[model samples]
Target: MKKFNWLLMVCLSVGFALKAQDNSMKKLREETAGKIKNAEKDTTGRLWKRGGNFGLMFNQGSLTNWAAGGDKLSLSLLATFNGFANYKKGRHNWDNNVDLAYGYVNTTSLGTRKSDDRIDMTSKYGYEIGKNWYLSGLFNLRTQFSEGYLYPSDTTREFVSKFFAPAYIILSPGIDFKPNDEFSLFMSPFTGRWVVVMDDTLSAKGSYGVDTGKHVKSEFGAYISATWNKEIMKNVTYKTKLELFSNYKHNPGNIDIFWTNIVAMKVNKWLSANVSLDMIYDDDVRVFENKETGVMGPRLQIKEVIGIGLTAKF
Candidate 1:
């Protein structure tokens, strides 16, 4: 009887221990599964990828009783934002980008002046046709958000441009070559481009290649664009883009050119230095010289910007 009682006690202990271990494992599995489900929900089923950054730069100077000459008092501020949304699945891809920049300066002598201004947006969608090649459609818009003036002298300010007074819109169906994530080339044998001048004064002047007294100008053309982006070294990056357009209806032999380059040096997580260069050549756009003489012609337009600023990425 004693032997049988001891054997029964040992069997009961073992059974209880095994039951406790099984319950612990079941609880662990439930917690793990719950965490995974929450993560999936946070990402919204991994449908889209998004990222962007914002930058602000400031410069100021004040000259008091100092003998050294200066602009008396001056202040400048520049703000920039860039963002992108990209979608990729089995055989379809869509990419979208937005870039905005505006800058201004105020001086006791020069008054308030716009130093830089731009609003650019692009969208492209593609379906894979072969290795590293896709059939794609692209749309882009370029404009500004404020009025611009030409200051011939300290007291002379002439209205040169305004929001949508000279806007460019382009649409193309093309073939895109993307051999890697850092480089892309796009070519479209046929494209449509529109130049818009919304202001009555500007439209009446036939600004931005528009017809005389017309608000809009349309052109059919062949377009090509190439882009390159890469990290040159630790905390340093470079990017460049070039685009060409030839109007088949008007001047098929003359091609328009647009090129831009940028270099960035990251000082820390929140500080950076950047430089940018942009150049544009358009046959239809004319630069007026000696308006007193009524002389106008086309010329290359170039701009450059360099600054150190606070930057935030997300």
Candidate 2:
């Protein structure tokens, strides 16, 4: 009788232990599921994201008594701002971006002059029509913030460009291929581009391929653009964009090219190093050659900048 009672007691203990373990596992599963549900709710409910970065760059030099020749006093300052507003929900997407940069330099031999100037803005909206493809419309504008001058050694500064003197506006209805957030390609066979010369003097001079005395010139064209951005490594990022436009109304064989690339490296919380390059070629825009030969023709334009600067993100 006692042996039977002992065996029964052992069986009861095993059953109780198994039941306790099962309850513990069930409790853990419920907790994990609750956390997952909260995470999904938090992310799906958010609609808009906005962020930007600001940078200030400076260069200065002074020479009083130096073995090598140098300027007495030189200083330069550059300010840059880049920002974006992006919205995504369901099958709709909208993105807007702005970039503004301006810089000036001064030297003992030369007076203050503009080193760089640019203002670019783009807005695009898309509705999903197929896998990784969207029917889209885009608006883009590019111009300069201040006046520009030509500095020939023998003569005084001659006005070459002013704000809105050669502003560009592009509107296109296209198909956007966005495989991911880091890359995009857009194409439009029917595109309208406007070249606006707001300054009367520049308009009268037929600046930027516009007819003499014309304030605005319009062209129908085909447009293609691609953009890519990626983090090369920790704390380093690279971005590039390429744009092509062929005017069907004019020289459709001669295409316009605009390309830009930027590389940024973070040094710390408030300091960074950056390099930027821009290249442009437009067939209709003519540049003056040597006065002795008196030749004028279209030419490629390029700009490059490298600097270490104070940066802020918001």
Candidate 3:
């Protein structure tokens, strides 16, 4: 009888120990699940708190021989504003940007004195189709006011002309491919332009010239750009951009020009600089000649400019 009692006690002890272990495991699982749920809620709260961003930039630069007359002191100031908005749970993302740039130049010691002012504005809307592809369209308007002289006959004649002699409106539809987070390629294979208006005075002056009554009806072109960005240090990023702009025209003799290279750098998040160089190779029929010489030849010119600027981000 004692042996049987001892066996029963041993069985009872084993059962109790197993039951205690099972309860402890269940309690642990419940605590772990609670922690996970709390963490998920915290993450969602943080995401909801995220908001839009605002940025501004100011830039200034000087130019020499701005009008091919001689060395001149040129001053330019620009202001830019940009913003980004986020959607809660949508396939499409939206951003808004505005750029207001005004520039003025004063020429000194050149027989032909001149001053110029210009303004540019642009707007864009974009749709995110997938991870690395985007479709976007943009509209741009630019205007310029200038009072200068073209010393063609060794005489400085007062001349006042609007830089955008014929105001232009451009419609651009393009696609962007981002192979990775830090690089992108954009090709605007299709683009169109409309000359909405022209300065009456400039048009009248041109009417007496070789292009008499000829107005730019439409402009078709393609633009391609490649961008690269890298974080060289903790808060510093290095960036480079290359762009090409060309116009394919129905009238070959129209303004045939090409603008080729642009290089820029960003130091930390608030300071940046850029250099732009453009080349123009035109056909004989498109060339402007001096009345003295009837000879025609390709003209080669180089323009180099540098800029220093301040940037802010929010």
lDDT of 1 by residue, 108-202 (tens): 98888998899988899989999889899999898999999877778888887888988989999999998987888999999999988999898
What is candidate 2's CA lDDT for residue 106? 93
Pick the lDDT winner. Answer: 2
Residue by residue across 1-314, what tens digits does model 3's lDDT show? 99999999999999999999999999999999999999999877643333322222333335655675544453344333333332223434333333233333333444323222334444545567887777867565644545434455544553534556645566788987765645766678787765433556555554212244454556678766565657665654454444444567654344434343434455656776644454544342223455578764446434444555765666
Candidate 3's C-alpha runs over 4 A off are 1-90, 93-108, 111-120, 145-160, 179-184, 205-216, 220-302, 307-314
- Tens digit of lDDT per residue, candidate 2, span 79-103? 9899989889888989888989999
**For model 3, what is the error of residue 305's alpha carbon versus the real structure, in angstroms, after optimal superposition?**
2.2
Candidate 1: RMSD to truth: 4.7
lDDT of each: 0.88, 0.91, 0.52
Please give each candidate's TM-score: 0.85, 0.84, 0.50
**Cα RMSDs of all predictions?**
4.7, 8.9, 12.4
Q: By TM-score, is 1 or 3 better?
A: 1
